[model samples]
Target: MHVVSARERLLTAALDLFAEHGVSGTSLQMIADRLGVTKAAVYHQFQSKDDIVLAVIDPALNRLGPIADEAEAQRGNAARREQVLAGVVDLVVGFRKVSATLSFDPVVMRLVRAHPALRNLQRIRRLLGGTAPDPGSRVRMAVIAGGLMMAGADPAVTGLDDEDFRDHLLAAGRRILKG
Candidate 1:
């Protein structure tokens, strides 16, 4: 069995609570209660819920870091562009369940909107920035990200498991690029 640290436990617990209850609905007390610890112990691990929020999100965003590298390395190649798009989709889809909830959460969105790291996020965005076909690229990017997130958790895509969803998404992506 893998022994988990308090930090990992806090992150897992935070994601669960935030998914069930939006960020505002959740509290350190709830997280501590879930872990059978006191709020102070939770605080000792993280100074604030916002800190925990960042911690939970950091892992997902970090995946994009590499996509940024791949994008820069490939420069202006069509293949490279597709690779970046495919990779971004794969990363989000890889964490579909949590990503789904986080993607839709108002608090998460608000925090991301106000995050000091906004400029830093631009680096990752720049990686796949050119993939957007036109002005609608923003909407398309959201759809692609949200699609991956929701598709990961979608039950109606019944025959579609994560792997299946990814395959379909990648195909859809190719089609999106072509037409």
Candidate 2:
């Protein structure tokens, strides 16, 4: 049987709590309670609430790195853009709950901005919009990024299955980026 580590459990509980309550609103105690453990147990796994928050978001950010790398490896600009957009759509659709939680939270935004992993995001944006994007590409990139995040949480799209959502998102991203 597969065993879940204490740190993994703590990070999972923290992400759930962070999703339900914004990172600022969630406490170490809340994460502990979610996992049916003491706050000291949480501390044993992570030094502070900020540490827990970082641990929670780190994996999601890490996943983006490979997408950008794969996109960069593509032969042509259109192929690279499509590859990245498709990868992003798959990620957002597959992890809609986590995406929504990370994308919309104000505290998480602040933390992510200061995080070293923020370079992954900059790289993705540069890949999508070019090394030095014009104002129009900048606007398109912003809309595609924001729209991908919102697509995960938007109630209007909830009824659609993951494949449908991903396809629609990819189409919209293509239009925005290429048009």
Candidate 3:
């Protein structure tokens, strides 16, 4: 049985197609085919590919928000904060290639940049602190975001099982987040 929701099916199919082909290259028709639904049904759920692009953005980012927020809030000392950051990293890297592509997509990048919700992302980044006062916070946040994207795409990390990958990434995150 198709356990995935229609919205979810479309989204999963759309992301795979979007990453593989790009926004301009992909069509609702293609997405419908990927989901084994009629074009009209897909259209009913998402007005257009643009709508799909918008819908996917937050889910992708918010995947780690709970953990990120927790880490940001729970962290007290530098060492503790680093531990929370490490949890955030593990949360993001959990999505692996999907998150990697979502991060790098020029289309989504442009959309999020213009989207009103851009504030949401900006706040998250500020919390992550792309550059810290010690000149280290900036590097850690950069490393946190960039590293998650890269680690997702890396073959070495990809080949490992979820538990193994999480363990290694947590370790990596601890070191990087602390620096």
The top-ranked prediction according to TM-score is 2
lDDT by residue (19-83, candidate 2, tens digit) is 78888899999988999999998888889888887777677677789999999999997788888
The order of the candidates by lDDT, greatest first, is: 2, 1, 3
Q: Native-vs-model 3 lDDT?
A: 0.70
Candidate 2 weakest lDDT stretch, 10 residues:
129-138
What are the lDDT figures for the candidates, one per model? 0.72, 0.82, 0.70
Clashing pairs in 2: none
Going through the candidates in order, what is the number of backbone clashes in each?
A: 0, 0, 4
TM-score, each model? 0.80, 0.87, 0.77
lDDT tens digits, residue span 1-179, model 1: 99999899889988999879978999899999999999999989889988898888777666666776776677475756677777866875677757656877777777777765555346654454534557677766556545554665565665666687778878876666444
Off by over 4 Å in 3: 63-65, 72-75, 115-131
lDDT of 3 by residue, 1-30 (tens): 758778887888998997799877899999
The top-ranked prediction according to lDDT is 2
Candidate 3 residue pairs that clash: 130-138, 131-138, 132-137, 132-138
